[model samples]
Target chain A: MARPSDTKTRIQAVARELFMEQGVQNTSLKQISDRLGITKPALYYHFESREALVRSILQPLLDDLDTFTATLAPGDARRLLEDCFELMWRHREVLVMLLHDPGTMLGLDLVERVWEWRKRLTALLLGPSPSAAARIHATVAIGGMSDCVVEHASLPFEEVRAAAVAAALAALQS
Target chain B: MARPSDTKTRIQAVARELFMEQGVQNTSLKQISDRLGITKPALYYHFESREALVRSILQPLLDDLDTFTATLAPGDARRLLEDCFELMWRHREVLVMLLHDPGTMLGLDLVERVWEWRKRLTALLLGPSPSAAARIHATVAIGGMSDCVVEHASLPFEEVRAAAVAAALAALQS
Candidate 1:
């Protein structure tokens, strides 16, 4: 048997693949267990419910975003924005899932959390007392980065990353 | 009794309003007819089905986009982009409906048409045989304008229009 920690990681990987392929609504715990070659009881030993499994899969990405946001300082916005584009590119599948099916796959509460995190991130990027134009600029910048990552997922990573960062910076500075 | 043309226009306006307020799936034909103070037969006379109504609402936007794209010249990319943003802003309610409930509300054919329109728009912006980076830049520029229009629909139109156009131009130039 895989070690407990290794088993948890494996479960998350399998679940993410299944969710992306067939959608979170169509995927079930049984399918995940069957793919993992584990029994239902074994799957239940780790995750109490499908929602719990989803939370487990998503928590790490959220934590990474939180850590990145927590490290923001003055004058670091441009570099940090680039880093953010890279991070989002690394996790593009999850981002696509969240964007494509927020209501059915993730539910309203989690969607609200993602929106709140984005609002905070935007505020941090723009700094204190930003004008309305500045706020709109930041919002558009982030939106541009997200669309680039999701829409051009098949492109070479380095090229897409560089282009998205450039576009985002231009939106911010304009 | 209202004129046939007047009734059709009234149904479209009321349906758009209700769809934005309570989502497309939640709003039924009966509710729409009730709000318009029309009988079911009158509503059915104007629109054979809800899908037909949705198509009617979207076809004009697509026609407008088609007309705009047909008029583009070599040096008109920037001006055309600004005009595209204005068009998107004017029809943002429909855009929001398509974004929020894409699968159930708009159906696959309509969504495919929207996607096709966007691809055509991107091609026009980037020109033929563009580099991957240029394509990404164009995608991001359009995405920025879309996000600005959809997310800040409550903001004054001129402010959002000016900010989105400026940001889109910067994204393209960068």
Candidate 2:
């Protein structure tokens, strides 16, 4: 039998897996509970709604971005940008979720968080006196790196990762 | 009085504007008709449903990608890619519409056309025997360009276009 903490983690994991496979709208608490061999009541003990479940699922991802961003020194621009790309590549599922489900209120809130992260990233990438074009370039480059892995769905995972990193680094240089 | 064709064109233009401004889900055919100073029946003469109106708006954009892709010669790989970016930049609003409200059946159909265009483009960018990693890089670089322009609401139009073009060209080269 799973411990209380273990059960809570399992629900999140199952919820995320279902969300990814079937989309956020289609996945219900009952479905998640069914998949986990837990009662629907058991699932609700951890999350009252799918929105709460999504937020819980994404909290760690947001925290990771925060932690990574906070660790960068002011002038460590290149590494900071690279780290951002690395984090995005590593957390491709979170991004896929963002792209596929940007319409929901939850999705919009997540997008706002993403936007804030991008602004901080842009400041870090272009230390001072970024022209309108340079700033746009930095933002697009970072944005591209975050979402590129999903489109390369046919390629082997490692190949996709390597290519994404290289292209992201190149975008940084330009 | 506008000619019949001119009236049709005006409705489309206004609908596209409203879609961009208010989003597809929020905009209604009645609103579109009223904004164009036409009766509901008149709007229906040109478009039977909101879905039809959206398709009419998107068809030209899809046709543009078709026309653009058809012009690419084997030796003009780089030019072809740049032209594609320019087309996307030029039709930024339509691209944003597709990105934001990727609706039900018809929306997916239009998106599939764009995907096909991208596949054709992927073929052109990478000559025979390009590595899997190269293909992924190409997808990131190219896909990122358009995706960035649409998502980065803060970036100015020309800067986004220029950065997308430059980043794509650099990725193609490297």
Candidate 3:
């Protein structure tokens, strides 16, 4: 029999493909199971629900983000911008899912989860206490990149990456 | 007796108040009715559900957005930014509502609605056929403003207004 870890990796791979094609809201467990050539029970044993599966897929990205932001200082704006775009672009589809509503309402406190992450990133970029305007610029700088990444998802990777990083820096400097 | 229109207006006001204070997902129709000293059925008589009521509250803002975007050209970024901020800030609570998931998942197609508006706004800013980078910058510029407004919700309105506008312009220019 295939290892349980192998089965788990296959599930994540198939689920990400289906989700990227049809959106997180539209994909179902049955679809994932069918595509994986596994039964519903097997899928259930792996993931409690679609939300659980989604969180599993996303947790690593969040961890990488946490690692990157953990030691970031205010002067690291360009590095932060470039690194964030790289991290986000790698998981652009999931980033799009989080940016939208149905995927966020997937019962895992995805909303609060993302918001807290944003707050942490914002504080890291602006320091402990930022002025209202400084706060807004940082907010805009970081918040602006995801949707731009989504909108330009079809463009060449390097093209989208450059634009998003440059635009984020401009927002910070503004 | 208070007029029917007055009751509808009062319901909208109270619902908005409750939604802004807590959040759309947490605010129930019953709570809105109780706050207005009306029955739930009376509330239902005017609107079908929380989603319907939210639609009623946000429609004008969308309408105004459509109106403003309806007549514009490229190089209209400044006027567009200023006018859009005015419209959005006045309805900032509802803006937060749409930005959020629970409020959006209230059975409204708000995700689609706002997305269509964004496409139109992006098109106007970048012309009908902007390059890939131009598209991303336009997406970043306009998309950048809403969260900045939300973050600085407490500061004097003018400060947020100036900062948001400047940040948006910087994004576009970048």
TM-score of chain A of each: 0.77, 0.74, 0.73
Write one digit per residue (lDDT tens) for candidate 3, span A47-111: 89766888898787667666655655555878767777777788787776555434344466555
DockQ, all candidates in order: 0.46, 0.42, 0.41
Q: If the candidates were sorted by their TM-score against the true structure, best first, what order would they fall in?
A: 2, 1, 3
Stretches > 4 Å off in candidate 2: A4-46, A75-78, A105-108, A153-159, B5-46, B103-108, B151-160
* Shift in Å, residue B127, candidate 1: 2.5
Q: Where does candidate 3 chain B have its weakest 10-residue lDDT segment? A: B99-108
Off by over 4 Å in 3: A1-43, A48-51, A71-75, A102-124, A127-129, B5-42, B48-51, B73-76, B102-116
Ranking by lDDT: 1, 3, 2
- Candidate 2, residue A81: lDDT: 54
Local accuracy of candidate 3 as per-residue lDDT tens digits, B36-146 = 998899998888876689788878777776676566456668877887677678877877765543334335555565667778777777778988788788777777787
RMSD of every candidate to native, in Å, equals 4.7, 4.5, 4.4
Per-residue alpha-carbon lDDT of candidate 2 for residues A1-174, written as tens digits (9 for 90 to 100)? 555578888888888787666456546788999999988888677778667787887776788877775675665655675677678766778666655545543443555666677777777777667776676566446666666656655556666666666776676566
Candidate whose lDDT is highest? 1
Candidate 2 DockQ score?
0.42
